[model samples]
Target: MNTKLKAMVVDDHPIHQTIIKQYLANKGVNATTFGNVTEALRSLQGNTYNIIFCDLQMPGKDGIDMMLLLNKHGYSGSVVFVSAMDDTIISSLTCMCRPFTFNVIGKLAKPYFEDDIDKLIACVCDKHQSKASFQKQIEVDEREFLVALAEGRVKNYYQPIVDTKSGVLVGYEALARWMHPIYGLLLPYVFLPIVEKCGLSPELFDTVFSNAIQDIKLHGIKHSISLNVAQDNLEDALFSDRFLARCSENNIDPKTFTIEITERESYSSNVNLYKNLLKLRLNGVSVSIDDFGTGSSSLEKLSQLPFNELKIDRSFIQGITTEQKDKNIVRSICGLAKSLNISIVAEGVEDEETFSLLEEYGINLAQGYFIDKPMPLEAITVLNKEKKYV
Candidate 1:
């Protein structure tokens, strides 16, 4: 227990506030209690707390409102939702807060046990420690992206997507990587946001597409290649035509290409994107809904789109071995995809046990480090020739 640790409890109920305060006191945490969000906001002005235990259903401004306010004010501390809300609402709130760059410690339902408080305290301490150890990442800009593109530093790395049962390579996913002179190697997270912000997704796509075609031809790998398609690309009327032209120029069949639409992109009611996706499918290109279960309107998108594949998000897949809830969720997704005649690909399967479980669940395909890390073009070519997993 760190005596220097500080936390705030924001709850209207006297009993709930007392319980949280006592729990914090037991853990040697300096705790502040606020009965309303207004006073909490005032407290935040003059003080900094490492963790905040917030209640959802309050008199005036609700917990969601407070969280949004906290995000707006750039609160970086961990937040624990202590509420009586149903599991679905709590889970949704948890998901909502995570993307705002806050460490969501977890949730405690009303009538929580002593163990729940203990777990919450442990989670906060762990997250705080992890956050403390995080290094400030280098921010990338549009100029750097253009320079990288011109210098031929923007490249594609291939990660093998395999059949769950036989472990045979059925396809490969093209992951973007940057060979930065200073940084050595950088993943998509470093520069993708800048590309998206600058509306240069097409340039990035072109680089990956060109590299993928070259890799396939060089290796003579007769399998599908999946590339992430940004929402901007989908919205562009000429995107499909441009992509087909590239395939034709490279002597690559459109049937051997798959476009993966990520859940992170908000494609809500974008009719043009839907039509373009449909057009691609009509032209023998496969479309997959990537990161399947994490999005807000997953079911709606599935209902509206002509996606032939559903990729269970890594977040759920990573938890399948340890969490029953994750297993159930994945099982449900498998059932739903099967009913729709959609192929299922489990992402982030890092162990034989997980791979076996996915196979049992009838997952059609899988891609993760357990199969192979994203390899360079030469390495992919060698692996294709050998027909072996390294």
Candidate 2:
């Protein structure tokens, strides 16, 4: 059995092309070499190659154009560009021309290491052999602007919140789960921080909101959707307007939605953050100080702003069954929320003891892996059908 992948090499340099062709041929690959784009395009029309290698700094038609031409021709294989420029610039070019072509696997700088090329080819061949590959196949108009585009991929998962008093379903927090082509299902902890760091929090938040609204419409359940909005994102005037506009576009009522602002972030003694929270309240969206009691300024700032809800951080709810200090903290938080007419939700209530204790403290809502683990949107649909509302 001959298992060989055909590879096409396109470069103006005779020596580099020869080296690549020889290397690929020696490695049991069917190697074809072309000195220009015309020959490469002609060969592509006549033959099928698993991958193509192109020189970025070509004379008439550059490597980027060749990649775009391959994309325009609907070639499904990967393209690898060789260049003397930095990989970052090539990556940017790839993003720019991604909509036009799918062949550029990556860019390789000049002064090539034979060993590195061998490794790269090996990785490409392995992907071709793998049954489960993470290569994205979607074609967008402007791939360079895809990160800002609204039509990427979306996945919605439900994290249930229960009534601690009766283990009844009160609502579920809609969590936006991204099934990235390269990265598998990512938790909020993994990508949320990175998104925030990259100054893309507003786009990320919009993606989350779009998915949440879709889920609510799909489930047809009157349950509330609690979403986290970064303080910085909320502070942006455009963000506030766009968010409200998106809600209007999706026909989601503000009454059934809650925006969670981290207590640690909102209570920084900065007046601007508080002002944004007040704007959220004025918009009729419930503003909850999330992870309450996790910060030193939480209790002091509770009275300073109009927070409609308080979420007791999981740290307080965890190990409460065994520790009196935990119980005391929960009691104090509940007392504070009640005194302020703020709805209290104890997050991370995993055990029966914690649940019962929370109900004793008059905590109205609870969520954790104890009552029910995070579930898919379909599972929530089934659960909603079975739930008997009081």
Clash number by candidate, in order: 0, 4
Give the lDDT of residue 22 in candidate 1.
92
The residue-by-residue lDDT of candidate 1 on 114-195, one tens digit each, is 7887777887787777767766667667898899998889888888999977888899899999998766788888887888
RMSD of each: 5.3, 16.0
Off by over 4 Å in 2: 1-151, 266-275, 387-390
- The Cα error of candidate 2 at residue 382, in Å, is 1.1
- 49-76 per-residue lDDT for model 2 (tens digits): 8878888888999877786778778898
Off by over 4 Å in 1: 1-5, 11-39, 57-65, 95-101, 110-137, 158-170, 182-190, 217-224, 231-256, 263-284, 291-306, 312-336, 347-362, 367-390
Model 2: residue 95 alpha-carbon error in angstroms: 44
Question: Per-prediction TM-score, please?
Answer: 0.70, 0.58
Cα error, residue 52 of model 1, in Å, equals 1.7
**Once model 2 is optimally superposed onto the true structure by TM-score, how far is the C-alpha of residue 242 displaced, in angstroms?**
3.0
